[model samples]
Target: MSAPGAGPALVLASSSPRRRELLARIDVAPARVASPDIDETPLPGELPRDYALRLAEQKARAIVRGEGELVLAGDTCVAPGRRILQQASDADMNRRFLELLSGRRHRVYSAVSLIDADGVQRSKCSENIVKFKPLHADEIAAYVASGEGLGKAGGYAIQGRAEALILWMSGSHSAIMGLPLYETRLLLKQAGYPIG
Candidate 1:
């Protein structure tokens, strides 16, 4: 069936502006953007990759849509070792997270899920390694004070002031910012979302 009503032609089950911007890069505009309400907390002992994929798929299926409509969702996670660093909610947590990541490489996993009209689901995950320069106490303090990392995973926003601290990286930049464009575009196109 054709896109339902006058929506963009797809449904984006996320509220992240970054995800929306990433989608625009591939020319896939959602017919309706519904921020899926779901528990984002990781299950006990869940690995970062598993958590990210579960969240992405859960978000996609959580959104209410017609049988003929399609929904897309995504999740990004920062993991140092097997530990998943959650979104920093305060300056203290930001400081602690940054200190842990001061001069080490961490994994950033981004997972995308697509649910088609017939309820078929497809997903892909992109993993990247990001290394940050050893940060001085003052530097971490200042970054925390800036508050850019407060709402970000692993207590940092790679797209903001935190970029200056990145020493090297290998992986999708878009994935670190919360969405993996290459994987996302491929998924959307394969699902017939009219994306480039």
Candidate 2:
């Protein structure tokens, strides 16, 4: 493992390929990639924004030993009103999530947190509005059968096959993918990481 402050090495606390790809886009090459296992059950009356931030912080803290390494973590949630729509683990759940988001505008919240070697934690939240086209029964079934939404939030991947269903999107594309590049860059810079 790379030592802390060894040319700004980062430890990414997530297993999401999308997030990993997003980090790569910003030229961040993590020295260690650790996925934090935590209870993601939302608390009673927890708003989506609060839930996202809490999860992000928890993830970063879970993987840290207070050694002062730069730890990065993030969480993304799809919310229609106060309801949070998470990744569908099965076909039925994907179908129901798609039915609910079809032809409607929903909010995507992504929270990013960074814990520096000094144990100082900083977090930022990014929100985006996405409008999806009405989906036909066949389209939904086909998409579900393709299994692309199996592990994606809101039962779709904005950067994958589901891109066809998006009518409009307002905000950073990287936010929808689970990391906001501008915000992430800011956090990394604050943590003393050099970004070209």
Query: All candidates' TM-scores?
Result: 0.93, 0.95
Please, what is the whole-model Cα lDDT of each candidate in the order they appear? 0.89, 0.88
Q: Report the Cα RMSD per candidate.
A: 2.6, 2.1
Q: For residues 1-196, could you state the per-residue lDDT of candidate 2 as single tens digits?
A: 2244556568899998788888878667788899899999899999998999999999998995535468999999999889998888899999999999999999999999999867889999999999999999999999999999998888888888889889999998999988988999999888887776
Q: Please give, for residues 1-196, the per-residue lDDT of candidate 1 as tens digits.
A: 3334533358889988888888877766677899898988889999999999999999999998875788999998999999999889999999999999999999999999999877889999999999999999999999999989987889998899999999999999999999899988787677666544
TM-score of predicted model 2?
A: 0.95
Worst 10 residues of 2 by lDDT: 1-10
Which pairs clash (backbone N, Cα, C closer than 3 Å) in model 2? 68-117
What is model 2's C-alpha RMSD? 2.1
